[model samples]
Target: MTGDIFSENHEVEYYETNLLGNMTLSMLTDVIIMISQDQATALGVGTQYVIEHGVTWVVAQTDMDITRLPRVHEKVQVQTRGSSYTKYFAYREFWVRDMDGNELVHVGSLWVMMDIQSRKMVKLDEAMVIPYHCDRVRRIQRLNKIPKIHDEHDIMQTEYHVRFTDIDWNSHVNNAKYIGWMVDVLPYDFLASHVPTEVSIKYEDEVTYGDPVLSRGKFINTDNQIQTVHDISVNGSTKSIAEVKWKKLDKKGSK
Candidate 1:
């Protein structure tokens, strides 16, 4: 398992669907992270393994391009492979495809090993790098930088209480939950008329239990696409930011 790619199939549960009956972006992200973890576990470098080594894997940045959204009850296949690594960062690629083998989504992510107690990034040792059998290639290149969303007059803002379920095994809010929070603040009419074609997120800090998070977003309409930039903050400090680009769908379902 150390040097091999891994894949898994999943049924899009009803709970994972949105009002449109298609898998929500956040839930789809959850599935991608879950499968990545499963593959890491099989390769012997997952949560427990990293924790035992006094560090944990944390996502630094992620970019996903979705061509089609899986519908509820649809069985989808997810495949992942470790692609490359440096002293402090590792890259991985993931794909989600429908039963007909048409790719629905492609994702590229950057991860860092962080010391649990100090919460500082640690350099990857041979032990950590060897097992991944990185191919030294990337399906989608790592994002150089995600632009910060500045405060503006028309930006929408909302406050949310961190719930227990939002926390993951690491005792912090899972990254995908941030996407959900961002979407929750979008105008209902916009959501009803458009569908996201791409999403990129950069995790700057962790949000923990008892932390009150504020979500702010700015929507932009271009000639061909609608874009939104979101920032999640705590105690007036920014924690994470995400950007989503959407394409309008007509009443007849044409993009």
Candidate 2:
């Protein structure tokens, strides 16, 4: 979906896929962001332009619907549009389609403008608002929902040593990469057996480069399947918190 105000396109890559040769949820999240940045660039209000004025956009939530997974060597078309703007937030939608126009994935996201110095979310400045030129952007009602925490301590836990590549423009670890780790540690057969139908994550805190983080995975049983839930925290420090939910099919220990 492109209006004159925004336009961008992306090509899929082989390394972006998993061992199964299909695009992964984590990679889709990155592609969604790149399209958003490209949209801003077309309008001359890109990240450099926004950052020059001491403000940056941070993704608050993303809801993704997957129809079919694009495989390796298949170059998909990724397009993005600035759907709307609110007081201090902007809503954007993205689509990934095959060359024949068959839709493969749909994504909608909410982003907040923030002050660069304070690192806190802030209202949209007048300059930031004037470019998009929309008085009101449609409100996205079904935002990606974060999983609820029932018992904070009883989750599957592991620790990760942060690497150099984890940081993105926002300066903390890129939110999507954590999801990659979640997929990596799960039983290989489980990943092979169940395709992820839905994923929702909450970014409660930021994990900086070089910070050690502890990741915990948990699950709830319902009607013979398990909803994989994960919470990540910086080791020895309560500084950062994050969570992810994986909708899994098939038995836990079965192939």
Candidate 3:
């Protein structure tokens, strides 16, 4: 398979944002899911099509950055393009833009093809991928480096056990669940006051079912916003599965 470009339209809903009219991290994640679905549809291999063949695409890693919030009732064009494909992985990029062609967010993701029966990552088969070719192709830059948590001295403490429900078809903790965990550890008052302008998640290990994992978050305040880094560790291997840096909408001068 060569590659292809895919695009879709997004109409922001009232429920997708916080009380301050800013987008939530959950909503951002939703947009990424929709864009990826659209991309697969463009390639004739959307979700239902994959399910028909008993195959699925699992998101392995992602790094998304947001510059501004898309307002309610505003229209955004979600554009996606296939970046590259290795034996076991494929790279994709997505962007959200306004009608005037202003960029709002950038999202990069790594996807792996799997043997649904074996439930393991498998090499991409030519027959399964030959349809996504495009005359237009672009390269997605890979960030070999992962984002680091700046402050590790916070008194914040959280302990949670990973359940079987947390594991996806890929047999790893669903990437979205990490975001949920990060959100869960935050103070409810803080969540009520702030909106997420950006979110970045880096997956380093697979979280098994029934594993008792501990979550820790460090909050670092910037000039006008706050950055929170979360750590998910099991058996003393502390790898950051996700990091979020967001602006505080409740305070003066907050971005």
Candidate 4:
């Protein structure tokens, strides 16, 4: 199992695209998680395997950098590898590329195993450790700590009720769903005019079914880039924080 880099091919489906006809950031994250699960299953440590052991993998943080997003019907390849692990954290790296072998996005994530009943982090076992074949070298810098959003800034907020579709087999809202919720709060005009270049998200707590979540966002403009910060909260308690950097695209649709 050592030295294995798992890969999968995908075609951007119509349903996965945004109004701009490009792949949505949330869907991209979903694809990354799907391919990672596929690889884990092949190595005998997937969702089912972990559930049987009363533990499941939970993402603590993720950072993604995008060069371009694929359009609907475009074929892409996703490759992922287990990069390393510590007493409580496991690191993973993912790359998405077009058929021409040009990279579309790069992602790095930190994960932890949690006991189902206790809902607390647990040390990874041999089953989880041996199959990953960790290299102990990071391909991307680890996710940076997202700063808390202060109230002094002009923050826009939206409320969303957790729907059934948002819940995964783990009986909680999927991590990627938070990204989608964050995107929904941005002004449509801004979304249509700019594309995200870098994204960082840190998960602090879990939002379960039937929970009402609030998404708050603030934007900062620099000469070359626009940065946005988002905080997702449940019952006034912050659950996750995310930051995105955007580069304005020319009218010709070039960055």
TM-score, per-candidate, Cα-based: 0.92, 0.83, 0.74, 0.94
Best by TM-score: 4
Q: How close is candidate 4 to the true structure, as a TM-score?
A: 0.94
Query: For residues 1-255, what per-residue lDDT tens digits would candidate 1 score against the true structure?
Result: 123578999999999987767799889888889988898788787778878989888888888888978888999999888777767778877889988889999888888888899999888665866787874432335474666775586989899999999998789998889898888899887787678888888899999999999999998656767888899999989898988888777753333
lDDT of 1 at 42: 87
Model 2 alpha-carbon drift over 4 Å, by segment = 1-9, 133-140, 152-154, 224-226, 236-255
lDDT per residue for candidate 2 within 57-160, as digits (tens), equals: 87776666677667777877887766667677777777888888788877777778878899899987757555655455445445755665468655666678
Ranking by TM-score: 4, 1, 2, 3
Backbone clash pairs for candidate 2 read 156-217
Q: Global lDDT of each model?
A: 0.83, 0.68, 0.70, 0.86
Measured on C-alpha atoms, candidate 2 has an lDDT of 0.68
Clashing pairs in 4: none
Give lDDT: candidate 4, residue 201.
92
Off by over 4 Å in 1: 1-3, 136-140, 252-255
Best lDDT among the predictions, by candidate number? 4
| Deviating ranges (above 4 Å) for candidate 4 | 1-3, 136-141, 221-223, 252-255
For 40-60, candidate 3 gives per-residue lDDT tens digits of: 776778777876777777776
State residue 25's C-alpha deviation in candidate 3, in Å: 1.3
Model 2 TM-score, 2 decimals: 0.83
Specify the poorest-scoring 10-residue window by lDDT in model 1.
Answer: 135-144
The order of the candidates by lDDT, greatest first, is 4, 1, 3, 2
